[model samples]
Target: MTGEAEQQLRAYVEYFRDLGVREFYRRGEPVFAVETVAPAVAVASALFAAPEPVAERPIVARKPDFLEPPIANPVSFDQLAPLPKSRVPASEKAAALLAVQQEIGDCTRCPLAYAGRRKIVFGDGNPNARLMFVGEGPGADEDTQGLPFVGKAGQLLNNMIAAMGLKREEVYIANIVKCRPPNNRVPEPAEAGVCTQFLLQQMDIVQPEVVVALGATAALYLLGVKRSLSSLRGHWHTCRGAKLAVTYHPAFLLRDPRQKGEAWKDLQMVMAEMGLKAPAKG
Candidate 1:
């Protein structure tokens, strides 16, 4: 082995020894240890010599299950009945979404859809608002009311907007998934995927100057980022050419009120982008 490689191997041995991992083999050969001797030997070797490169193993390919045909032939596409025409158009996706609401006035896309009698929770507020807030999904009150962010969390969101000198009507609000998840839980990745097009269409129609992701899920869906809220919050990012900011979901702030300070800081960042100062904390 090269001198550098030998040194690196020695360092690895020392590191593992420091972590109390002794009785290791060298060059694929087993070596017995009494106690401190084994560890010291490993560390000494690591410090003095470089590690040897292990030989590459041959890769084995496995056959897929589909290689063999099923005993029973499946129904052919031509034999199946055609699906109903989608009113949503490629260009007028927003209008199509509204039409979809009318069609499935009461939907059952997810289990939450059937838990309670629900009206279509079409998102409310300004369709032309400059700033839009996108959340994870709906909850009990929101599911029942057919709106996004209308529970205690929604109320807090309203107060947050008010603190920015605006009302709910002045900024649009929506969610990554329109329907609530079962038990008010976060929407699954599949559910978010099913509903994401509608959100993209909604943003296209609204053409908002900025978007605020209310939580990690919203940030991940809208911005394709998977950073912690602490890392993502209070910073300005961008998505689809619009300025983006992230903050703790109001629901989170409700549970951990201490985080409201950080949320307020994120809001100030949003306000600064709008050329307005956030209201001073009382």
Candidate 2:
């Protein structure tokens, strides 16, 4: 085969590998004129290029179920349940939130409950907050403190709220999942599926006027569609009766500080909609 053809075959193999499509099966004997090429590359080449019929019988092998990526049809928050017939009265929002927390007492509803979780981080911040921030999940600091966003990411989130001319106490902060996943990894769909039911209830009670999804994972579960974050940003979406916006997670901004400006842009959009003004430099 030509060098260009060989290079094309390698790219296909890498692309599939990145998608977790490992263990490709050979359909027929190698069709390439060169016998020196490896068997795996030969199979890839045939799949990529038009095939000339060969004498060997076709072989089909099913990829193992264990190797498959986790699949879930996440239900959007709006469709999870009908909104309450009447909004919880603001005078009793705090007690209603506390009742939801008590309902989750010593919970073992999901695998994350047993995944070395030190505490179930229910939520924190104003019960009557007009703004809410939803993050992916807890980390070591959050798990230890049993409150959302108390770590470095939390510190950065506090700054993000401050930038919006609001104190952290003025906004409700929670996560897609209350418990920290093992090693701060993204929560599995099954895990998030179970936990977000509570989050939905929390949002219903707090009734924030605007909700900010702090990362792709939070956006995925909140919006129930897996689109790029950029597409979801700079637009208005509704969730549980509030306008929604997507932005970079503080953890991500910490890793790539340059994007902090972009995150600020997202927050500024929220601020403008809410008629908020940042504090003057003094």
Clashes of each: 6, 0
- Most TM-score-accurate candidate: 2
lDDT per residue, candidate 1, 108-134, as tens digits? 443334333355456777766788899
Cα lDDT of candidate 2 equals: 0.83
Which candidate leads the pack in lDDT? 2
- Residues 132-179, candidate 2, lDDT per residue (tens digit)? 999999999999889999999999999989988999989999999998
User: How far in Å is the alpha carbon of 224 misplaced in model 2?
Assistant: 0.3
TM agreement with the true structure for every prediction: 0.62, 0.75
In TM-score terms, candidate 1 sits at 0.62
